[model samples]
Target chain A: MDEFELIRRYFAPLSGAHEDVVLGIGDDCALLAPPAGHELAVTSDTLIAGRHFPEESLPFDIGWKSLAVNLSDLAAMGARARWFTLALALPEADERWLAGFADGLKALADEAEVSLVGGDTTRGPLTITITALGVVPAGCALRRSGARVGDRVCVSGTLGDAALALERWRAGDRDRSDDALDLRARLDRPTPRLALGEALRGLAHAAIDLSDGLAADLSHLLRASGVGAHIYGARLPSSAAFDRLAPAAERTRLQLAGGDDYELCLCIPAARLSEVRRLAQQIGVALTDIGEIQAGSGLSVLGAQCEPLAFTELGYRHFQ
Target chain B: MDEFELIRRYFAPLSGAHEDVVLGIGDDCALLAPPAGHELAVTSDTLIAGRHFPEESLPFDIGWKSLAVNLSDLAAMGARARWFTLALALPEADERWLAGFADGLKALADEAEVSLVGGDTTRGPLTITITALGVVPAGCALRRSGARVGDRVCVSGTLGDAALALERWRAGDRDRSDDALDLRARLDRPTPRLALGEALRGLAHAAIDLSDGLAADLSHLLRASGVGAHIYGARLPSSAAFDRLAPAAERTRLQLAGGDDYELCLCIPAARLSEVRRLAQQIGVALTDIGEIQAGSGLSVLGAQCEPLAFTELGYRHFQ
Candidate 1:
């Protein structure tokens, strides 16, 4: 099928009628009315085949992960997901692949209550780029530069599960244990903490979604806020699977430097710690205290006795 | 350089402080406050190296055209440019190429008064995807489905110059004439008619930007509007270079089916023709009455005697 036919058959139905979306797909541009008294939280992300995921990855998972990553950015900003545009580059228009991909994308979009507003499809190397737009009450967006020296650093959900799954998959460790299967699922489909993020809007001082591991991503938050972080290595949260399967040193490595965890790393004021915990509990997501913002300008992970621990790797970088 | 370093060095400087931009790069998401009472016109476009442009094309031109094509979509919707996000996937981060690309992108962005808000940089095949968001007055977006019978089908500026340039360049015709150089320049930098599109806003019944040739793109507008058009094949505009160098038949072929024109195809009520012409004059963009919307469906290209002409190709289609 040609570009237009592919769009009409596979992509068009993905767009749903929404009150804010004045015009959706099949337009020169999607016309959307931003809710009054709201600021748009916009983020863009691209996933490339073989580079981002396994070459044999299911199209459904690719579609889910593409939009999920961008939504994670919105979540980090404490924005409510509203709309997204997909710019898809594929080697060819494979009907089966497109069908599965659309299904995967629509499933998450439906859950997020976000509409597929507009997009472009072209023929090239398989690359899926999604630009997600969300809305937050004006002046209420959680920024990375908002963290104070005394703020308590926290993260929602488990860390390094997705990266561990990727490592195992790459090593061809086909252990079909429940933990293995769960890790693979985590790698394939990350859950964006939209509800938890929105819940933390007023309470959290600073936030960032973990993509390039806690070390690198949190370092960014620290640099942006001009503060340091003293992370308690033992307090780093992990799934039961992670705890059971990973060796001690490997677990520490993955937890600190393994990337692709879609969990939100946040800094909350000391006074708001209880409120933030209650909120995360109400939202049904695990929130863990990982570190504290400090007055200095570097990151240090503390050992069991509060001594500095040496870290070998920070995180993944695109071009190193 | 790593992804974050590359962004900080090359892309961050592209972002200018704008009143509407609550937060720019360095955050999880860019915070933007859309103008009050204005609806956002959002569009996304992807340019894959060797697919969208010649692999050897200058990074400058690649960047310019990448954002320019997306702006063309916004222009077609009659929106004023505002903010855009760039999602770039490169095999490696070449400093010189990134600098040139940023320069090219900044040149056009500055002219359009749009700000670079945020983006993603990932390791992959060279691919650039931009999601541009513009704004138009509420209830005033020019849409593709608004055409009615008897509306004058108009197009801004010239067509086929870029396509002809590509044809000649592919043939390795190294002609040094001014026309040859102009054609090549056109291919490299097809200007998006933002001013003309904004001028045609309320006066035009329907609009579309020409990317896939006049024949195919206009057919899309026709299909969307549920109307047909009797296009004067000879009236398809051509640059001085095209008139001087292109053979008659080749000219017609290129004008009809040449993709990459970035010009606006508009449907204006016959009564508003004079105003549109005057406005085009004011905007310093050529406006040509190429056809008239008629009852029924499917586009028709007419000869000098008003007889229907047979055109073999419609336009370029990926995976065709």
Candidate 2:
């Protein structure tokens, strides 16, 4: 199969039936109509083979994760994903790979109700670039610069599981235990917290999705909002797999600074904590109160007895 | 510098001062307000290091052409350029390269009035993916499926210069003559026909940008419109450089099938011909009447004496 054939057979069918998508694949450009009173949220993310995922990763996982990461950005902005374009560069037109990729992409796209409207395919080292568009009411979208000094910082879902899985894989611990498989699944197929993010629009003062670990991502939010934060190390949420398999020291390190978790880190008013928790419960995700925004600069972590823990910045940095 | 610093220092300033951009870089997602009564046109294109351009090509050319191709798609749709997102993958953090790339990208973006709303940077083999969004009045966007029998075919600007430049470069004809430099410039900085495309919106029955050569790209428009066309080979536009340097047979071959011209190929009703020509002249582009659309499918090229030319599909195809 060639580029056009691959697109016609695998990608074209992924363009979902959405009323707002006036035109989709096979056109020079995809025409879209954004509803009145709504602004568009746009985000772009690229996942390169070997740099992003393992070189041996399944095509399905790469496809799922590529779109998932972009959607996570929309979730952080309290936006409803509407459409996305995939610019894919591959070494060859492998039919099986394309089939698996399209399947994985369609699975999440169906769940998110987002359409694949347009894309470009070319020959090169494997890379997937997805630009996702979402809609949010004007003046109601969450932003990283809205965190206030008195806001309580919260995160949806558990942290560090993806990082833990990656660590195990890198360490050559390929034992296929149920816990290991579960951890691997978390690393491969992260759930974009769209529902939780949209629900927190009026309740949360600021929001950001955690990709480069909690320490690094939260610091970005703090820097943008010009506020500091302190979290109790003992209060960090951990998955059952993480608690059972990871060492105590590694647990804290991974939770604080290991990357790849697609959870939302948000700053909500203290008075809205119960309501936020209730919404999290309704959404079926753990919304942990991890820290409190402070007036100073930088982040600090407190130990079990409230003594400040030594901090290290170990977030992932590209081209380092 | 790491990815964050690279983005902050080099890429962020490309975010133009556009009111529709409620939020740009430094956020998880860029917030954009599409104007009321207009629909958005979105397109994505990727240019890989060795595949799309010579591996030794300048970073400036790479950046400029990467965005140009995407805007070309919007131009084909007769949309006014607005905002874009870039996904870049680089092997290393090279400040010099980044600076040159940014300068090239900003030049065209500033002229086109398109803002860099958001982007992603990662470590990998050099790849650049850009997704551009534009707006056109609802139900007024030009499409490939609007051609009808007897519609006059027209094309803007010259063709074959870029392909000839590549041919010369590959044959090691690196003469520093003005013609050689001009051909090289065409290869590197093919102009996007934004003004001509926007002007052709109501005048043209169907339109497409000549990227994969007139033969292949026009075939696509014909397939979409379920029509056929016959163009006079002698009427195909050629730059002065091309006419002066290329041999007779090669000239016809290249003009008919060469790619990367970035010119618009439009099918206009015979009644609208003079108006489109006038608009093209106003936009400072050459509008040539090539032929007329036919009732059947596929394209046919007529030689100088009006005899049907034996056509060969030498147009660029990935993974061929």
Candidate 3:
């Protein structure tokens, strides 16, 4: 089938309707009305086959992960996702693959209540680029530069499971234990902390989504805020699966430096800690206070004995 | 350099500050505040190496064309360009290529008054995807499905030069005559008719950008509007360069079916014809009336003597 037919059949149906979407799909452009008093938050992520994902990965998973990563970025800003556009490059039009990809994308999109607006499909190596747009109250959007010296740095949900899962997968460990399966699920279908992000809008001073591991991503917040951080190694949250599979040191390393964890690392004012915890509970997500912002530069990790821990790797470097 | 550093060095500086962009590069997501009572128009385009452009085409040309095509989409929607994001996939980070690409992209973006918001850069086969966001007055944006039966079909600027140039290039014709060089420039840097589009916002009934040639793209407008078109073969605009380089029939074919012209195809009511011309003059762009929308469901082309003209190829097809 031709490109037009391929898009009409596989991608068009995925563009569900929304009131804010004045025009969706099948136009030179999609028209959207950003809600009054709200600002539009936009972020894009591109996932290339064999680079961003395994070549053998299911198309469905690839589609889900592609959009999920963009949503994580929006979630970092405490924005409510409203619309998205997907530009896809495929080596060839495979009907089954397209169907699976559309299904996977639509599922997450529906859950997020975000409409697929306009996009372009072209011929090339398999690559998916998704630009997600969200809305947040004017002046209330979370930013990385808002952290204060006394703010408590926190994270939502467990970390290191995805990295640990990738490690096991690369090592060809076929252990299908419940913990292993859970870790694999975390790696494949990461749930963006959208609700928790929205809840922390007024409570958190600064926030960033964890894509480049806790150490590196948190360092960005600190750098942007012109502050430092002291993360307690003993307080780092890890999935039960990660703890069970990895030795203590490896688990700590993954928690600190492994990537692809779509959790939120936030800095909440010390006075708002209880409120943040209450909101996290209300949103049904775990919130862990792993560290605190301090008056210096760079990040320091304190062990159980309160000694600074040295990490060999900071995070995943895309071009390294 | 790593992806983050590469983006900071090469792409970040291209993100000029704009009043509407509350947050731009380096944020988790760029926050935009569209003008009050204005709707956002969004479009995306992807250009792949070899498929979209010649493998040896200058990086600057590729970058310009990539964003230019997306701007053309916004122009078709009668939107004022505002913001854009670039997702680039490169085989490797070459400084010279990146510099050229950024320069090309920044030139057009600055001319269009659009700021670079946020995007992704990755390691992969060479590919560039640009998502552009524009703004239009509420209830005034042009759409593909608004054409009326009696509306006069019109186009901005000339057509066929790009296609003719591509044909000559493919045939190994490296003619350096003034006309040949002009055609080559047209093919490489076709200007997007943004000002004309804004001027036609309230005057045009329907609009579309000619990326897939006049016949195919106009047919999309016709199909979406549930109408037909009667285009005069002799009235179709062709640059002097195209006329000098192509034979009569081939020239007509290129004018009708050539892709990548990056011009605006619009449908204006018969009564508003003079207004459109006046607006076009004000915008300093040539406006050509080539046909009229009809009540039927297919397109028809009449030769100089009003006799029906038949053509084999309709336009470029990605699958083909």
* Residue-pair clashes, model 3: 0
**DockQ of candidate 3 against the true complex:** 0.90
Task: Identify the runs in model 3 with alpha carbons over 4 angstroms from their true place.
Answer: A313-320, B313-320
Q: lDDT per model, in order?
A: 0.89, 0.90, 0.89
Q: Which is the better candidate, 1 or 2, if ranked by TM-score?
A: 2
Steric clash pairs (candidate 1): none
lDDT of each residue in B1-320, candidate 1, tens digit only: 77768888888888987899999988999999998899999999888887788888889999899989999999999999899999998888889999999998998888888999999898888888999999999999999999999999999989999999888878888797999989877887778888887887889999999998888888888889999999998898899999998877687788988889999999999999998899999889999999899999988888899988765453434312
| CAPRI-style class, candidate 1 | high
A1-320 per-residue lDDT for model 2 (tens digits): 67788889999989999999999898899999999999999999998888788888888888899999999999999999999999998888888998998988999999999999999898888899999999999999999999998899999889989999999999988969898888888899889999998999998999999998898889889999999999988899988988999887688888988888999999999999999999999989999998899998888889899988877433434312
Clashes of each: 0, 0, 0
**In angstroms, how far off is A127's CA in candidate 1?**
1.3
Candidate 2 local lDDT, residue A5: 82
Q: Measured against the native two-chain assembly using Cα atoms, what DockQ does each of the candidate structures obtain, in the order listed?
A: 0.86, 0.88, 0.90
Clashes of 1: 0
Q: Which structure among the candidates has the greatest DockQ?
A: 3
